[model samples]
Target: MKYKIVNINDTGVRSVLIIYTGGTFGMIQDASGSLAPFNFGKVVDRVPELRQLDIKLTVISFPKPIDSSNIGIQDWKDMSYIIEENYAQYDAFVILHGTDTMAYSASMLSYMLEGLNKPIIFTGAQMPIGSIRSDARENLIAALEIASAHNNGNPIISEVCVYFNYLLLRGSRSQKLRSSTFAAFESENYPVLAEAGIEIEFNYAALKPHDENAQLNVINNLDANVTILKIFPGITEHSVKSILSDPQIKGVVLESFGSGNTMNFDWFIDCLIKAIEGGKIILNVSQCIGGEVEQGRYETSKKLNEIGVLSGGDITTEAAVTKMMFLLGSVEDVNEVKKKLTYSLAGEMDMMEE
Candidate 1:
């Protein structure tokens, strides 16, 4: 990947680095007319809107851009290392990622980069840039503008965020909900930090303010020994037991039926109890797209609570998985990991007040 310095005429401009990590936004048609990943460094020529922005821009492409479906812990580490290594040299950072796992990457990056006082904006498009009606140009251009936006000589947004369609959302709180529409992501429980219209209207109170004195630190080690158990009607105990008893599995996300309800069978309770006793961390999250998990309200869910399943209130699946990995990496004791799962470390979960 080659990078060149591009100059802008507007004054008060700062440099922002756009890191391209393979996605639909960077895809182009080949000779056979099949969509394939293209070198992102060539995007500037295709989308001239970038030149309209006052900020100086630089591009960095992953040596081997990966499809979002194939993204893993190693990819997360690689992206974090780039930001960590270049934190001081740039004013802010923008990442072009696939929408399929954009929320997961954004959430993981939020936890991995602690005390970060610079903007880390993640954006992508559902359609390729070469298409006639591509949403890529606006998303990419606006992301750069948001990343470079400053107030009182400080970056306006100091936290990790996702910019898509016309809204800016907290990275950890967003999820990709649509497949064919221009508005492909949503922040279920949180409000938009900023909205782009004729003019960008920033909700001042919603933005994460910069803490100039804080030093950026990256948590590179992520544990992948976690599993998700999504509950459905007629789920068998044998299937559940096999997953829990797996020697390599260290954490489990139990996606319970609406509001964290589960089958109250004796064998089901016994399997969960044995798993908890064996030091496996179990977290109960609601299956509904917009509700919080309430584990002790019903008889079925009460069994889950009694057996030591932690409740994940109003957390998206993407946030839950990354949070589990984050906790698994930071904590050494199994008890501590369980406790932290219930607690909101990066504002990933909304805890109901007593």
Candidate 2:
């Protein structure tokens, strides 16, 4: 699972470990014109420009490359193991992930890798590498360059980030917005951390400064007994009841309307009350891309605050769902879980007024 490509022209270059999980970025077409996963050991041959970046590169590929949609809890665990095992060997890490679930995986990774002191970038391509006008070369090359980036003898970026389509977004803050176009990801509520043009321009003030003395911790215990219920007009109490009917369900991310407002119906409120009384952790998140969940900003959401529904301020559903998994796995007390969800755990949300 290990292959090295030494840049010929550069001397004493920093190293980057590329973890290829599976995606269009590493695919090639055969005589039948169907896309197939390429042997990553031969990647340098497809993208010769890797030699010019002058970064010592090593790769570790999954035994079976899967579409981003197929990524699961086990895959997340395996990816963490790779990064943990090689934490000391490489300057930074770049994950070759599929575009479909890249944001979810990246957001989950942000929660898993707490107190990070080096960059863990996730990037992929809309077109296959073997295509005449493939974006894989640019994306992978930029990712490598950013991974090796350092300033004042310290790394420029020391957190989990998603570098895609010329922008570098905070991993948990980003969401995949498009599937057909190259502009597939966006961080609507947050500012861009970095951008690549003629040069890679970084917003230093936006970058989360890391504590070099802190320990690098990777979280593996995530409780997947969580569900997301997006509230729409006329969403039945029956549907909500059915979802919450399972006694084993630990947490739910209620994707409500703007500013966390929901249908202010008696049955709806009663349903929520029953769940909260049943010891279920219900987190309120705004369905809008650019706003925070203000629990008491209006009459509809005031009940959410009155009934112990936790407000997830401006946190995307990607982060909210995964955050629930992380918190539920670590803490057993429901009140403590509610407290943790109200605050920023790894910059996933703004510290909302409780």
Candidate 3:
């Protein structure tokens, strides 16, 4: 795919490459008053304040923009490939993506790009850039600032993150919780990496430190065959069987009730046991927004642990699904895949105690 590159600034000490992959942040009112992708080559025209920051800005845009809802495995490969190809040339990266699936994309990218030591910040808006009351300007400006930030010649933020509204969140830990508000994303299980007030304040302890010796590794292999099975109050056995019995599904993110509790009915337990016996890796995550999955803390969840279901402690559904996909596709050993699911990879989950 051909990329459109535009140099917005060339004199600053740090250079940041902006990867535009269609989103509301890049939309503008067209001749028909409909939202359309704007000419990002003239990004400085839309946000003139970008020229004032002490950072060199360059944009590489997708030839044909895509809605975030349509983002898939190939798009992930394309994004990671671009970052890999330009790794040596840019100091940091800013990805302008749609808010709908930004967390999923960011979570997957955190896994795909291993041994990363530079910032890859994702940012988007709930409203179009052309709108008079749009929050795009502040979000873009702050994201650029964070991406270019460094301490003693070292990148302050070495991991993938999402910058929206005023909070800088760890990518794998973030979840989009709102649709009609400016505060659309939250990292309930993790702390904000930074906050933008009158000035940008870095959360020094929460950041992943930059490692200069680590080389970038971009893994393009991702299996989309994984599925999420959410347990509801009145869910039927037929529904549970339909998902667990599917042979093509290699892994499942079981979104269980409070603290990973589920129906203790014999049929439900039997279904899980059969799925595990058939080589399906099941990870139990919580339906609650802010708690860890305590697999055996309650009687309802004891059967899940006894039947070989893995606990996804405090991991968001987006991260759990994508992490399962990443591990299943890249790791050949089934046992190794199951083992990795129990622990934190890329800070997506909190470490469970033995």
Per-model TM-score on C-alpha atoms: 0.95, 0.95, 0.98
Q: Please, what are the lDDT tens digits per residue for candidate 3 over residues 1-354?
A: 899999989979899999999999889989998999988888888899999999989999999988999999999999999999999999999999999999999999999999999999999999988898999999999999999988899888999999999999999999999999999999999999999999999998898877899999998888989999999989999999999999899999999999999999999999999999999999999999998899889999988888899999999999999999999999999999999888877999889522
The sequence of per-residue lDDT tens digits that candidate 1 reaches over residues 32-120 is: 99999876766767787777777777787788777888889988988898899889888999999999999999999999998899999
| Candidate 1 residue-wise lDDT at 248 | 89
lDDT of every model, 2 decimals? 0.86, 0.87, 0.94
Which 10-residue window of candidate 1 scores lowest in summed lDDT? 1-10
Stretches > 4 Å off in candidate 3: 352-354
- For model 2, residues 1-354, the per-residue Cα lDDT tens digits are 433333332433687889889999999998899999988878889988877777778888888888998988888888888999989988899999999888888888888887789999999999999998988998999998988999877889998899998999999899999888888899998899999999999999888886788678898898999998898997888898998778989899999999999998999889889988998889999989898998899999998899888888999999998889888887878778888888877777767434
By TM-score, the better pick of 2 and 3 is 3
State each candidate's clash count: 0, 0, 0
Comparing 1 and 2 on TM-score, the stronger one: 2
Best by TM-score: 3
Range of the 10 consecutive residues with the lowest summed lDDT in candidate 2: 3-12
